[model samples]
Target chain A: MTIASITGIGWVTPMSMGCGRDYKTLTAEAGKLPKLTSRMIFGERLPRFGRLDGYSKLGFAATGFALKDAHLDQWVEKRPIGVIASTVYGCLATDIDYYETVVPEGGAFASPNLFAYTLPNVFLGEVAIHFGLTGAAFVINEPELSGIAGLRMALNNLILEECSIMLAGFCDAGRPESFQYPVEVTPGAVFFVLEKTPGDETLSYGDLDMDIEGTIFFKGAQVQNLQNLMQRCIAVQSI
Target chain B: MEIRRAEIKKVCIVDTAVVTALGNTLQDTWKRLIKGDSGIGPIKRFPVGTYDSRIAATVDDLRPIQDRSIIYDLIGRLLAGLKDIPQDTALITATTKLGIDNLENIRRKKAARAGDVLPSSMPEMVSGKLGLKKAGINVSASCASSTIAIAQGSAMIASGQADAVLVCCADIVTEFTFSGFSSLKIVSPVPCRPFDKERSGLTLGDGAAALFLMSDERAIQEGRKCMATIKGWGIANDAFHITSPAQDGSGLASAIEMALVRGGLQHEHISAISAHGTGTMYNDLMELTAFNKVFCGRKLPVYSVKGATGHTVGASGGIEVALATETLAAQTVPPTAGFQNPEEGAEGMISSKPVYLKGDYLLTTNSGFGGINAAILLERGTNL
Candidate 1:
């Protein structure tokens, strides 16, 4: 079996936003707190952000950063390269919006755009279509550990030769005013690219730094988001 | 697909259970499907006559208990006789929308439990009810969710990482999905007529099914009833559209061809095909195109249970696979319910009466809103 190596990283946090390898500049410029915007993160690469919900926006921006870090930004590999993402409350914002469109009196004011993103897996579709990934992609719903579980599934697929490269992570935004969850959350997304180890095809990718766990094996990785990368890797798939 | 040789493993489904609109159990559901019974009717959750559509294939008992609880009940009934779960058993769940009914209640200021709105709660409920601590996956591949779940579960077992896997899928007819499809103008007022020239759109439904899968060796050692063997599976994305299939059916054909290649079989060996057949103009047409292209008009006899069971969304794939496996075991092909006439591409390939065949293989396919396609190949129980 092939051991998956985390080669590229990208994250969105309350205080930082960039590729995973830019630890020094991110730390030095840590004072620039909370600098993750659609324009700043995605530039002019992605589709118009006006139509997308917040969850898709957060995930799309992080995916763009990961693709950049993996040097697959403008290329489409003939081989299979997929995505797997887990979310705590996947698109709850849009779910609320879509639901408010209907009434009990046989009147519905639903928006087709909002209805499209209601499914949690739509995030994977957005990243797949945007990045031109046409392989086996999956969406997992769990706690923060969903990210690690997503990574394990990605590795399993890679080992089985189902896909050559994978982008696995978690993205979640706080619930709207009406809906109440057992736990509170912040708007965040963290994604990483995983590939089989010892590959000369991806030397352009900086280094194989992080493991299956969310731990950053690199130095000067004391950022808050780095310290707590989507909760912890709880080894949920080791059945 | 470029076919490649693979070291195949022997994974077989030991037992199965279902809670469909047609019936509560697999046997009852099979009888209704074989007889071409229509489980579709007018919507009762709310007034539907005001909209362009008014019919759906809803479960007889969708009220009083939450829709998410149906999976729990089904799993409990399925595992009632089991005393213990194998330590190596894993869980893989699939559903496109989990607890959307509860979310709708909250939006309408109706009484709703907080846990119903949580997606993780479904798997957590399954694990907790089954008395397990390890985490499991909840797949959300739109309509292909459960198909991918079963495929991935089989993959895990075949790869020697898991001894058994519990695969479950469920989806309920909700105002969210009903109105969403209605807003898209794809919900039929009457029963959906899949593959028929006059077919208008799909009919949403509520249901769930569970399958306990294990390797053939394990099943024989434990003396479990191996219903069918999971021969092969495949997944692909069209990258074409967000809510529709590729115009030429290339993505679906790729998935079907890959499943056949992986199963080490040819089109001549396949006895029947279970299509996605959502009754939408594009979906049925695209599936027919793929079938004609892959089978080359061999009269393989394609059928879609959606007309009888309603489009169960996430649960349709798993239920269809289970029914197809049962058909293989019994040596019969269920009729394509509500199919009055075959469309242009599917001429002579669909029938309204149960067709008996003496082949070992069945090809099942499903496509979702995100241009994702999944196909699975199964062998008869006797072959295993």
Candidate 2:
């Protein structure tokens, strides 16, 4: 069995923005997300933070909080800390934003800034650059942004010793405006910093157990979803 | 503490299939590749009057099925040639933009499947068609999507997560992508000349590929002929820029070094390299810089299929993997089509003629828009 310690958790949602342990219950109404500034998250200027698309902005803010919660934000050198993020409607809004530029002016007025952020993985690169992380980084597109898939894959990488640490989560900045069906998608992000289970569990939230087949378990039960797992970790820590 | 070490399993490529501008099957692609034919041509699928670079290696004959997304048609043609894949095999689909045309239709208020807009939809459709138990995850790491997918599948098998995996990827040339690249100003005005002195930029292409991988014991039990060995793989981000690679090529160098260490092979053991030579000035120079850094200026043979097939975006890596198996079997690296004059740094490494492989292992590398670089090492297959 491969075991990992959940050292930190962070999320940025319409309801709240803070560490997972400090997160409040889901009672706040969903609406427009607050303007996330680098000063609010990092207390310093993040290079290229202003040019990021909304999707990358949401993901970058959440990852920054997670690193801060883990106290790994002050690193002076590069580390092999990988990142694996999952999403459902990845960069669709940005895709639309970029596409709209192509229609009016016969593509002569296409925006390279918007074009750069079209792929979901661009934010991964952004976060890597911000944190000086040099490990295996990629994005997963799941049917639903529950983040279990990415979490499992992160555990596998840890088991295989592919990286020293991993930041695993999901971020969905839902289509700002849908073209059809008026579909509503919740815009939020949740990230957890994971590392090999340490001998000292003093700062760990909980232990994540996984078999070689990639089935993950926590507290002797199979992990159902990201929300449930976060709740369980918070509950155990509060005790 | 009863800590159990993860047992490493031997992963092998049993079967492969591809549909590119050059041909519809691996055999056809290999035949044309060795003969040094270019499949890239002027674009005709959509209106290109407004675009600066109007040519691409498009599969011109493939019409959308049922007036749906062209990606479905591309996938159908690529999968129709594959056979006998295990029902339990996990599926991982890769694409920079899956069914992106559907988004165009939805925007223009035309009929289209809304589900197809999501990258996950590809695996959902493929799993339902093939009755796969698991609706696999989709890797959307820009152009490195399929390469990372292959790496993930190999990791799954190496860690005993799945007995078999089928990695299928597809991408089509569309106005959206054409316009995006045009905006980036990296589209070559002519057919791309990878690693060439006069290389302008990349020529976009339409392509798809399906590679089935299995454990050595499972392949032996199923009596499947192994085509190549999945020796090692690594993925890394440049952390330098989103769209541009580091000038020093340290990111790709790290990935290649990681792959070498994982595979337990030295740089000299690699017979040749299948480079992600997209023909862009910065990209070609970056690849040469990385090769020089990793191989210590040994003058290793390097080649690119994009010169013939154009840059297939996410599908390029998968297509190249299919080509790598053939390269390993035939012990030859195909000519870098469109390559007439080699770049200064790539003088002895790239050529317009095919080169015979001198070793069993081949290194295939790809760098994408998000500064994502991936490298996979493949060993010539041997009987179990």
Q: What's each prediction's TM-score?
A: 0.89, 0.97
Q: Given the true complex, what DockQ would model 1 score?
A: 0.37
Model 2 lDDT tens row, A1-239 = 44688888888888788776565454446777878888777777876788888788899999888887777777788777899999988798899889899888778899998998989999999898888988888889888667888998888788777786899998888765665534456888889999785434576887788865666788678897887777777677667
* lDDT, residue B361, candidate 1: 92
* lDDT (tens digit, per residue) of candidate 2 on B1-384: 122344588889999999999999989988998999989998887778887788999988987676479889888888888898778898999998988888888878878887777888889988887888889889998988999999888888887888899999998899899999988999999999999999999999999999999999899999988899988988888888889999899888888988887787999999999999999999989999999999999998999999888899999989999899999999999999999998998888898999888789999999987778999999998887
Per-residue alpha-carbon lDDT of candidate 1 for residues B124-225, written as tens digits (9 for 90 to 100):
767777766565768888999999899888877666556688887888887778888888888888789999999999999887888888987788888887
Q: Tell me the interface RMSD of every candidate, in Å.
A: 5.1, 2.2
Model 1: residues with Cα > 4 Å off, grouped in runs: A25-38, A45-48, A76-79, A144-146, A197-239, B1-8, B66-88
Residue-level lDDT for A238 in candidate 2: 61
lDDT of the candidates, in the order given: 0.74, 0.86
Write down the RMSD of all candidates, one decimal each: 5.1, 1.9
Candidate 2 segments whose C-alpha is farther than 4 A from its true place: A21-31, A45-47, A181-184, A197-201, B1-6
